[model samples]
Target: MILFLGTKSGKEETKLLAGISCPYCKQTNTLSAITSPTYFHLFWISLFKVSTNHFVECSHCKRAYYKNEFTPEMRQALGID
Candidate 1:
């Protein structure tokens, strides 16, 4: 018997931030935050979530910000500790 295994990313959810400006575009209320949960799978069945990815995008500039690049202001806007 053969088995298949891999990691898959789940659906992403977006949340708009208020009273926040994109550092790249300097636009207000254009920051959309999204998070993806990566799951370990076996035979196409998700076994458990390995990690979650956090990111923010600027609508105007189309720039992507990852967790490592997240600023204090951005973290506050996303309500992330």
Candidate 2:
């Protein structure tokens, strides 16, 4: 996941999670923070007394984007290179 940490210079820290996109299907996939649900409860409880976290699964291609990285088209449109 992309951690947004503010810097002393008043700039945002951009942490990108790199991965390969499927050529034919053009699907962007990412790794999950946790896979199994067996330790899910314990993992969550370690931090907060009550917390809520969501793991998203793409319905179309079944890919995960924890950081929600942008696509080439999006980058070009936003004038980001």
Candidate 3:
């Protein structure tokens, strides 16, 4: 028998960034911060978290920004350190 083992993405939590504006949309208070975790899985069951990802998106333009792409202002606003 063969067992399946891999990593899978977990639930994402979203928070509205009240003071942040979307770079693409240029709309204030339209940015939302999304956070999710990647888990190691065995036989389709999640074992442990491997990593966490952070992203920012615009509610109006639907633009997404990755962690690495986040600006200092964005990082400070999101409390990401």
Better TM-score candidate (1, 3):
1
Candidate 1 backbone collisions, by pair: none
Q: Model 1: residues >4 Å from true position, as ranges?
A: none
Question: What are the C-alpha RMSDs, in order, of all predicted structures?
Answer: 1.3, 14.7, 1.6
lDDT of 3 by residue, 1-81 (tens): 999999999999998888777777789998889999999999999999999999998889889999999978799987888
Tens-digit lDDT track of model 1 for 3-81:
8999999989898877788887789988889989999999999999999999999988999999988889889877789
Candidate lDDT values, in order: 0.90, 0.35, 0.91
What TM-score does each of the candidates earn? Answer: 0.88, 0.21, 0.83
| Cα lDDT for residue 21, candidate 1 | 86
Ordered list by lDDT, greatest first: 3, 1, 2
Model 3 ranges with Cα > 4 A deviation: none
Total clashing residue pairs per candidate?
Answer: 0, 0, 0
* Steric clash pairs (candidate 2): none
- The top-ranked prediction according to lDDT is 3
